[model samples]
Every structure is written in structure tokens, then in C-alpha cells.
Target: MATKTDDPKVLAQNRKANHDYFIEDTVEAGIVLTGTEIKSIRQGKANLRDSFVRIQSGEAWLINCHISHFEHGNRFNVDPTRTRKLLLHRTQIDKLFGQMKEKSYALVPLKIYLKNGFAKVLLGLAKGKKNYDKRQDVAKKDAQRDIDRALRDRQKY
Candidate 1:
């Protein structure tokens, strides 16, 4: 019973991606989906939490993404964790392949959304963050929050 909106509606997001990696760039890519899969996504039954993008044989594939089976799909239901192909321009794919050659670089799916009634994924070119880097990010966020709080308090005085 999820309501469809005129604006693009996000179906799933990887909230941990930002905390675990430093995203350098992002690209919007189309995903290959079955009828049942699309139906399930429209109902907001999708998870990008543990999903990651991989390039093999010059093609990008989405792995570990979970798109729940449509309750009414019955025999049409596909595996929730099936590997889905991602569609990108030839140039874009080549660029991603080049960047991925570096050991530190990775491709991650940031979120999935409906754009113009078609499903799209926001893919990120990211570098993994170390434990210390994560701690630093947390500290910066806390400091920013404190500054905002002080500004709000000052406005009330």
C-alpha cells in the first residue's frame, strides 16, 4: 500500500555506505528487473543494505541486493538475493573498470529509486575508510551538531 509520488521515490538506501567508505563520485544506472521484482519494489519491499556492485567481463553486476518477493507473485517470484545486471553507458563502464583496477577503489550501490517510473540506482565510486577515519568522521559530525545547537540556543536568547 505504498503511495506513489510524482517525485522520484527512494525504495532502498545503504545508510552505512557513507560511514564505511569515502564516496568519490556517483552515477545513475538502470537495473534489469523482472515483472515480479518491479512489483515488489513498488511496494517498498527492497533492501540495499548489504549490496555491492562488481564489474566482471566488462559488465557491472549488482550482488547481494535483496528485493523481496511479491506476496501475490506466487510461482513468478524470483530469488530475493539474485544477482542483477546494471546498465551503464560503454564509456561509463570503461571508466569504472579503470578506477576499479586500484586496490583501494570500489563500486557501491548508494540507493535505489524510481525515476520517471523506471527503477534507477545511484552507484558510487568509493574508497574504504579505516577505523581511525571513521572515528574522525564521527567527531566532525558531533562538532557540527554542537555548533548548530549553540546557534539555535543563541537565537532564542
Candidate 2:
């Protein structure tokens, strides 16, 4: 059971985005939500996995996000998986749109959190990594971990 706080404790994160995409930039945008949606989010019933940002008609939106409906709210509940509008400044929206025209550039949601009592999503402007790139990254991480362990052991013994 997750408790709602004024400062949002992260409920879910898209870890795959970090592994698969080279995040060039990040921007925080507020999410528009209804009462029930807000309640559900407070309960930690949200998924950022398989969710991404899209710019259309100069507006940014969060698509494919699953925010489960509030269990107690019946007829008053809103759609759980609706495409929600993202609140971003005009300049930021324009910049995002311009970069999105390039091939292989995409907008991925890194995480959703409550900031100052408002729901905010961290959007990443990223480029997808190739298979070899991922493998190289994994190897580098393994090597770094081994080096750290070796140094720690030497310091103790």
C-alpha cells in the first residue's frame, strides 16, 4: 500500500529506456488528470512502461500510459488509458517538435512523480541504441564493477 505525499515518491520507472535509448535531453511536464485518476496514481496503480511522448498540432501528450481507475469510484471514473495532455511551455514544445522530425529520434517517458503536489513526467529526447552498442555498454559496466571490487579488496587486505 502506497501512501500519497505532497512530494511524489516515484511509483514506477521505465528502466528499459535507459538501456535502449541514449537520452540526449530531459524536460519535466505536468500531466492533466481527473479526480479518480489522481486517486489511482496515489495508490501506485500506474505504468510508465510502453509509454512515450508525442507532439501533435504543436501540443505534447503522453500516450499508452496505464493509470488504473479508482476502485471505489464507479460511474465517476475516467478512462484508465486515455492519452493525457502534457503541460509544456511553447518554446519547449517547439524545440521538441523540431527535433522529432529527425530520423531515429524519439520521445520516451523516464518516470512520473508528484512535484509540488502536481503530477509531472520526465520526458527524454533519445536515440535508440543498436545491439552492439548495448553489448558494449554491458561489458563496460561489468569491467567497472570488477575494478571497483578489486580496489576495495586491496584496500582491506
Candidate 3:
């Protein structure tokens, strides 16, 4: 149950983004949504998995994001997977475009949240991670967990 509070309420997040890519930078941008779309999102029926951001002709668009149909919205319901516009400044879009042209950079949607009664997306400028990198990360995490568990047991004894 989400209540209206000053803090932003996260509606959806891409958990695999951190595992598949190395996020270099993040930018927050407003997302355009229809009546039903907003309602669906407020109910936490949005999915950021496998969704991405694209800058084309100086405009940013969110592609492949899914927002389930609102239960009460009949005729107003639209395509759940429709492309949506992302509002960003021209300078920011140009910066991302230039960086993308230079390397294997990608724009991944990291999170979708509601702030100040508007929908916002946190876009991550990321580079793809190799399989070896993922393995190393997992190994490090396992080691850290083992060490913490050992210390906790020692304190109990």
C-alpha cells in the first residue's frame, strides 16, 4: 500500500541491469503517460525488465517497457508495450548520443518511479559486462558473505 509522501515512490525496477551491464552514468527524465497508463503504474503494474532508452532525431524514447492494462479502463486502455516519449533536455540528449557513437554504450532503463505526481525514469548509460566479469562479481560476493557469517557465529559463541 503506497501512500502519497514526499519521497519518490518506485513503481518498477530492472534488477538484471546491474548484473548485465556496468552503469557508467545515470540521468533522470520525465516520462509521458496516458490516463490509464498512469493509473496502472500507480498500482505498481509496471515492468522495466528488458526495456531500453533510445535517442532518435534529438528525442528520447522508451521502448519495450510494459505497463499492464488498468482493470477499470476499458476503451482507454492502450498497447501495454507501446513506445513512450521521454522528456530530456537537448544538451543531455546530445551528450548521450555523442558518447554512444564512440563506444559500445547502451541506454538501459534502471527504474521507474513517481515524483511530484509525475512519472520519471532513471536511465543508465552502461557498457556490457563480460561473462568473466559477472563470475568474478559473484565470487567476491560469496566470499564476503562467508566472512560475515563466520564473524556472526563467533560473536554468538
Candidate 4:
């Protein structure tokens, strides 16, 4: 069978979440999708940026994610940015809800990948970083890069 280049292993990712928050914990969650939605995702047309998870009435919901319409779906395609449900265990949902009650804690989607013919999202339990905190992280990364470069140069000499 011929493989399609569009069937992305990691369909979508949210890189900004790392820079904006301190991820304390992560959870893998199954996502609910329509036929067309899954096809669109497989086409690498999904976006996880600006998406977030929320627990309401004991249910986990994914909001603000966008999955492009399938070209051949026609009437079967749903809204690209519609809210979607996330599948998680009851205890897990409860725990997340409690954690979310904290002022600084937020739920962010780190990435989404196709596993075993299913779509799964990596959710991050993150605490928002302050402006100075972000600056410090940037500085630390810069320092690390400089150190690595120096080590490489020393090895070459």
C-alpha cells in the first residue's frame, strides 16, 4: 500500500505554550472527532495554537482548536474552530478541575498526534509565566547555547 505524505505523525503543535507557561504536568487525552475532521487532520491541516482545555460539569472540553474542512467532505465537514470534547477518566477530570481552580494554573494543548489510528492530544497543566520569568528563560537558553558553542570550538582546536 502506498503511504500518504499528509498523514502526519504529529498533526499539530502549540510551541508558544512552552514560552508562555511553566508546564507542571502533562496528560495524554483522546479527542472526539467527526469523519471529516479526522480526514482533515490526517491531511496535516489542523492547528493547535491558542487551543485550551476546560472541565465543565465534569466533562473535559477542547476549545479554540481548528481543523480544516476535508476537501471532499462537502456537507460532512464541520466548523473548523468548533469546540470539541476531550476524553479523560472521571478521576483525572476531577483532579484537573481542582487544579484549574488555582488562579495561575491553566490547561494548554502542547501537541496532537495520531496513535493507533486514533487522535490524541498532549495536555499540559501549566502555570503562566511572568514577563521577567520569560526573559530569564530566554537568557538561560542563550547562555546554554553559548556554552555548547564554546565546547564545540574547544573540541575542534
Q: Largest lDDT belongs to which candidate? A: 3
Question: How well is each residue in 1-157 modelled by candidate 3, as lDDT tens digits?
Answer: 7667778889999999999999999999999999999999999999999899888889999999999999999999999999999999999999999999898699999999988888999999999999999999999999999999999999997
RMSD vs true structure, all candidates: 2.7, 3.2, 2.1, 3.1
- Count of backbone clashes, every candidate in sequence: 0, 0, 0, 0
lDDT of 2 by residue, 1-157 (tens): 6555676678668999999999999998999999989888888899988998899998998999999989998998987789999999999999888888965589999988877667789899999999999999999999999999999999997
Worst 10 residues of 2 by lDDT: 2-11
Give stretches of model 4 more than 4 Å off. 1-8
lDDT of each: 0.94, 0.89, 0.95, 0.91
Candidate 1: C-alpha RMSD to true structure equals: 2.7
- Number of clashes in model 2? 0
The positional error of residue 21 in candidate 1, measured at the CA in angstroms, is 0.4
TM-score of each: 0.94, 0.90, 0.95, 0.92
Q: Write the per-residue lDDT of candidate 1 for residues 38-99, one digit (tens) a residue.
A: 99999899999889999889899999999998999999999999999999998999998998
Tens-place lDDT per residue, model 4, 40-136, is: 9888899988899988899999999989999999999899999999999999998888888965589999998987778999999999999999999
Q: Mark the 10 consecutive residues where model 3 has the least summed lDDT.
A: 1-10
